[model samples]
Target: MNSIDSVTLEVADPTAAARFYSGAFGLDPSRVRVRSCEAPTTGFRGFTLSLVVSQPGNVDALFAAALDAGATVLKPASKSLWGYGGVVRAPDGTIWQIATSARKDTGPVTRDVDELVLLLGVEDVRASKQFYVEQGLTVGKSFGGKYVEFATAPGTVRLSLYKRRALAKVAGVPADGTGSHRLVLSGATDPFSDPDGFAWEPTAPLTVAN
Candidate 1:
C-alpha cells in the first residue's frame, strides 16, 4: 500500500519553523526538515498540510495552539460543509488546515496532534489520481473528477488530491502563481513530481531477500 512517510518544507529559518511546528502541533521535530530558500515573493497557492483529529475539541485546541505559536489565522475554527476545521498560515508561509468529521462527542482534548494528511492541489485531479494508482496506491474515497483520496496504512500520513482552484479556495489563497511548492513527500520507491509539481522522494524502500 502507498503511504506518505514525511514532508519537508523550505523556509528562511529552519530552526524557528521547526520549533513552531513541534511546539504548537506536537509534531516530531525530527520528521520536519528545515532547509534554506530564497525569499518567495509570490503568494502560496498550491498545497496544504492537514491535521485530521478524531474529535472537534481537539481541532479547536490545536487551532488555538497554532495561533499562540505565532501562526496567522486564515479561517477561524467552525463548522463547514466538509466538517469542522480552520485554516492558518505558519510563520514560514506554509498553509495548514485542522479539521474533524461531524460526529457527536469528540472526546477528550489532547495536547498532541497525532494524525496528519497531506492535500495536494493538482491541475488535473483525475490525472494525478491515476498517477498515484499506477504507483501502487489504492483508492479510498473519490469524487467526480474533482477530488480523490488514497488509503494509507496505519500510522502513515494520508494523501489526497483536489483541483488547484478548489484547493486554493479551501486554503484561502489565490489560485494563480508559480514557484517551488516548498514541500516534499518521502517513502515512495522513487522520486517524482506530480502534474502539479509536488515532489515525492524515496526514503528507505523495503528490501526483500533474493
Candidate 2:
C-alpha cells in the first residue's frame, strides 16, 4: 500500500521552527522537518497537522506548551461529542490540532502521541478520495462525502481528506487561502501533486540531525 514517508513544512526560519517543534511537541526532525521558504501565503493553508493522544490531560499538556512556545490558540482545549481536543497555530503559521478520543485517562498522563495525522482540506472530498485511491492508497474510513481517511503503515503519518470549508471552520480560520500550501508530503509515489495542488515527492534519504 502507498504511504507517506514524512512531512516537511516550508517555513521562513528552519532553526526556530525546529526549536518550537522540539520544545512544544517533543518532535524530532524524523517526524516533521522544516525548510526555509518565503512563499506568498495568506489565511488558511488548507491543511492541519493533528496529534492524537490517549487522554484529555495529554491534550492540555501539549496545548499549554504550544502556547508557551509562542503558538496562538485558535480554539481552547475543551470537550466535545467526539472527545477532548484543541487547535493552535504554530509560530510558523502551521495549524495543529491536539486531540484524544478517550475522555478519561486510563494511565498516567504523558506527552506520548498516539497518531500523527496530516489532513488535507480539499475542495471536493469525493474527488480527492478517488484521486488517492487511484494512487494506490486503501481507504480506512469514510463519512458520506464529508471525510475520508486512508490506511497508512505503522510509524508513518496517516492521511485524511476533509471539505475545505468545514476543515477551515474546524481550525477556526477563514476558508479562503491563496498562494503556496507551504506543505509537502514525501511518500513512495512518484512526484505528483494532488487534485487540490498538494504536492508529493519521492521519499528521500534520512539524515539524522546531530
Candidate 3:
C-alpha cells in the first residue's frame, strides 16, 4: 500500500523554519522536513498541516508554544462543534492547526502529538480523490464531495483532500493563492503530481534481512 512517508516544506529560510517547528511543535525531521526555496506564493498556500493531539489541554499546550515561537494566531484555541482547536501561521508562511476531538482533558498534559495530517486544498475534491485512489491510496473516509481522507500506513502522515474554499475558510484565510504550493509528499509511489499540482516523490522501500 502507498503511504505518505513525510512532508517537505519549501521555505525561504530553512534554518528558521526548522527552529520554529522544533520549538513550536517539538517536531523532528523524520516526518517533516524543510528546504530553502524563494518560490513566489501569495495568500493561502493551498494546504495546512494539522497536529492532532489527544485532548484539549494538549491542544492548548501546542498552541501556546507556537505563539511563543513567533507564529501568528489565525484562530484562537477554543471549543467548537467538532472539538477544540486553533490555527496559526508560521513565520515561513505555512499554516498549522492544532486540535483534538476530546473536549476535556483525559489525562495529564503532554506535548505528544497523536497524529500529523497533511490537508491539501484542492479545486475539485472528487477529482483529487480519484487521483489519489489511482495512485494506490485507499479511501479511509469520505463525505460525499466535500472531503475525502486516504488510509495510510501506520506511523505515516495522514492525507486528506478538502475543497479549496472550504479549507481556506477553516484555516481563516482567503481562497485565492498562486505561484507554488511549496509542499512535497514523500511516499511509496513513483514521483508524480496530483491533480492540484501537489508533488509526491517516491521513498526507497526498507530492505529486510533474513
Assess every candidate by TM-score.
0.89, 0.96, 0.95
lDDT of each residue in 1-210, candidate 2, tens digit only:
378889999999888998899999998578698888899999899999999999999999999999999999999999999999999999999999999999898888888888999999999999999999999999999997999999988899999999999999999999999999999999877889999999888878765432
Candidate No. with top TM-score:
2
| Span of 10 residues, lowest total lDDT, candidate 1 | 201-210
Specify the poorest-scoring 10-residue window by lDDT in model 2: 201-210
Segments of candidate 3 deviating more than 4 angstroms: 204-210
State in Å the error of residue 157, model 3: 0.3
List model 3 lDDT by residue over 12-79, tens digit each: 88888988988889986778888888889888889999999999999999998988999999999999
lDDT of each: 0.80, 0.92, 0.89
Model 3 — which ten-residue stretch has the worst lDDT?
201-210
For model 2, what is the alpha-carbon lDDT of residue 180? 93
Q: Model 1, which residues run further than 4 Å from truth?
A: 39-41, 103-106, 204-210
> Model 1: per-residue lDDT, tens digit, 25-60?
888644555666774536765889898887778888
Clashes of each: 0, 0, 0
Ranking by lDDT: 2, 3, 1
Candidate 3 local lDDT, residue 209: 16
